[model samples]
Target: MTTIAVVGGGISGLVAAYRLRTRLGPDARIVVLEESGRFGGKLRTVPIADGPVDVGAEAFIARRPEVPALLAELGLTDQVENPSSARPLIWAGGRLHPLPAGTLMGIPATSGSLAGLVDVDTVARIDAEPSVPLHWDRGADVSVAALVGSRFGEQVVRRSVDPLLGGVYSGLADTASVRATVPALAAALDAGATSLTEAVGRALPPPSDAPVFGTLRGGYGVLLDALAAASGAEFHAHTAGASLRRSGCRWEVDPVGEVDGVIVAVPADRAATLLAEAVPAAATQAGRIPLASSVVVALALPKEAALPDNSGILVATGEDLAAKAFTLSARKWPHLGAREVTLARASFGRFGDAAIVDADDDQLITLARADLATVSGVTDQPVAAVVQRWHGGLPQYRAGHLEIVAELEAAIAGVDGLEVAGAMLHGVGVPACVQSATTAATRLLATVAG
Candidate 1:
C-alpha cells in the first residue's frame, strides 16, 4: 500500500488528500496533519440568529469552474445560493458612491462613467489616456497602480482601484502585480491596445445575468465538512509537522512516521521551515513571500437597524476609519435576511497595516461598530457579535510575483515525491486554492503512475 502525508488540514490540503484517494484508490493511505486544532483554515462559520453565517469567506466566484464543480461532486449543488444584492458602494469624497457599472476591478471601461466616483480633474486625466500611446506588450507585467495611475491618474487608483483590490488582496494597489491580480486587464495591455477604454471593452467577458458569485445556502462550512468527511484521510489535528527528509525512496515527515509522498500545504513561512533541508532554494523563496494579517467582526443587529441596501461598502484610502470594508450581510444574502435579523460585517487591516489587527476582540468589535454606525447610521447595539483575527492570513503578490512563483515551482520539481500547494503559492480565493490543489494532486498521482 502506498502511504502519503499531507502537512496541513486547510481546504487546499484536504482537497489534495481527497483527490489522491479518488485517484490512487483505497490501497493508498493518506494522513493529514494540521497545526491548528480545528480544520477549515479560512472557511469558518459562526453561529448567528437561527442558523450559521460564514465569518470567513462568504462566497466564491462562480465563473471559476473548480469550486462549483467540486461542490457538484460533493453532492452540494442543490444548496448553492446566489447573493441577493450584487451591487457594491464605494465610500469616497465624504459620501458613498455606487461602484459604477462596466468596471473591471474598478478600472472603468469608460472613464466618463467614473465621474460620479472621482473628481473632475481625475476624469479629465482619464479621458486623455487614449491619446497616450500603448507601451506594454502581453508579456509585460507591472503593478496595478503603475499602469492604471500612469494612464488614468493617481486619484483613480487611490479612490477606486485600491479599495476594490484591497478588499480582495488586503494589499495596496501600488505593490500588487497587475498580471497576477487582474489578468484580463494585464492581457489587454499586453496586447498593445491603444486605449484603456477599448481594451477593457474588448477584454471583459460578455454581460451575463448569471450570478457572478455563489455560496452554500447554509455556509461554506457545510461544503468543507462534507469534503472532510468524504476524504477518508486519517486526520491528525494539532500535529504540526516540523521538517522533511528523504528516506531512500520514501519521504519522511519530521517527528513523525514515513510516507511514500509528502505534500507541504501550510502557509509559505511554515512550508519554508519544513522544506529547508530538502529543497533549500524553494524554502528560501517561500520564506520571502509576504503575508498580511486581517480581522473580521460579525455583528447581528436588531431587525430595524436600517442598513444600506447595497451588498457592501469598500472604504477608500484616507478614509477616517480603521475599517477597510463593510458588508451588510443580511442585505446582501437573502437567506440571512430570511432570519428576521440584521447582520453586518466589518474588515480591518491591509497589507502594510497590521497594528489595528493586534487589538483585543472587544476593541476590534468596538472599532467595527463605530465604523458601521458612521457609514450606515445604525448605532443600535448588536444582538450578538463575533470577532475573528487571522495572523498572516492573506499572501501578498508583489510585482514580479508570477516570476517568483515559477522559480519556486521549478526548485520544488527537483525533489521527487515532494509537492507544495496552497493559497500562498497561487491565487487567494477558495476556487483558486482548489485549482492549485487539484493540479498538485494530479502531479503527485502522475509520479506514482510513472
Candidate 2:
C-alpha cells in the first residue's frame, strides 16, 4: 500500500491530496499535515451579523477554468455568482475618482478618459505618449511600473497601477515583474509592439458580458468545507513539518512519518526549510522568492454609516492613508444574504509596508478605523470588527520571476517522489493555486505509476 504525505493544509495542499486520491484509488493512504489548527490557509470565511463573510480571498477569476471546473465537479456550479457591483473608485487627490473605463491595470486605452483624475501635466505626458517611439526590451522581463511608466508616465503607475496590483498581491508595481504580474503586457512588449496601449488592447481577451470574477453564495468557506469533506485524507492539523528526507524509494516527512510520495505546499520560506536536507538547490531557489505581509480589518458598520457608492475604494500609493484598499462587502457580494448593517473590509500594508500588519489587533483596528473616518466621513464606531494578520502572506514576483520558478521546478523535479505546488509557483489567485495543485497531482501520479 503506497501512502503519500502532503505538507501544509492550504487550498493547494488540500486540492493536491484530493486529486491524488482520485487517481490512486481507495487502497492508497494519504495524510495532510497542517501547521495551523485550521485547514484553509487564506480562504477564511467567518460569521458577521447572522451571515458568512470572507475575511481573506473571496473570489476566483472566472476566466481561469480550473476553479469553475472544480466547482462543477463538486456540484457547486449553481452556487457560482458574480459581484453585485463591479465599479471601483480610486481615492486620490483627497477625493474619490471613478476608475477610468476600459483600462487594463490602470493603463487607459487613451489619455482622453483621464481628464480630472490626473493632473494637466500628467495628461499632457499621456497625450504625447502615442508619438513617442517605444524602446521595447524584447527578451528579458522588466518591472510593470518601468514598462508602463516609461510609456504612460510616473503618475499613472503610482496612482492607478500601484493600487490595483498592490490590492491583489500586496506588492509594489515598481518591483513586480511585468512577465509574471502582467503577462499580457509583457507579451505585447515581447512581440515588438510600437504602442503599449495598442498592444494591451490587442492582447486583452475580448470583452464578454460575463463577469470576470465569481464567488459562492454563502462564502468561500462553503467551497473549502466541501473540498475538505471530499478529500478523505487523514488530516492532522497543527502538525508542523519540521524537515524532509528521502529513505530509499519513499519520502519522509519529519516527525510525521514516511510515505511513498510527498507534496510540499507551504509558503516559500517554510518550503525552503523543509527541503534543506533533501534538495538544497531547490531550497536555495525557494528562499529567493520574496514575500509580503498584510492585515485585513473586517468592519460591520451601522446601517446609517456613509459607505462609498462603489463596490470599493483603492488607495493610491502617494495618498496619505494607512489603508491600501477598502472593499464594500455588503455592496459587492449581495449573495451573502443582506442584513440591516453594512459590512466593509479594509486592507492595510504592502511590500516593505509592515508597520500596520505588525501592530496588535486593537492598534490595527484603530488604524483601520482612522483611515475609514478619513475617507468615508464615518465617525461612528463599528458595530463589530475582526482583524486578521497574515505574516508573509503574499509573494512578490520580481523581474525574472518566471525564470527563477522554472529553475526551481527543474531542480525539484530532479529528486524522485517529491513535488511542490502553491501560490508562489504559478499565480497568486485561487484558480491559479488550484491549477498548480492539479499539475502537482498529475506529476505525483506519474511517479506512482512508474
Cα lDDT of model 2 by residue, 1-450, tens digit: 888889989999989988988888878888999999999898898887657778898889998799999999889999897887558888888988888777777777778777778899988888777688888867788888888788888888888888889988998887799889888877876777788877777677787887888898878888888888778888998898888998988877877677888999999999989988999998988999989999899988887777766788899888898899998877787764266788889998898977778788898789888988888777768888889888899899999999889988999888888999998888989999999999998898888757
TM-score, cand. 1: 0.97
**Model 1, which residues run further than 4 Å from truth?**
137-139
In candidate 2, stretches whose alpha carbon ends up further than 4 angstroms from where it belongs are none
lDDT of 1 by residue, 117-142 (tens): 88888888888778878677566678
Among these predictions, the greatest lDDT belongs to: 1
Error of 1 at 312 (Å): 0.5
For candidate 2, what is the lDDT? 0.85
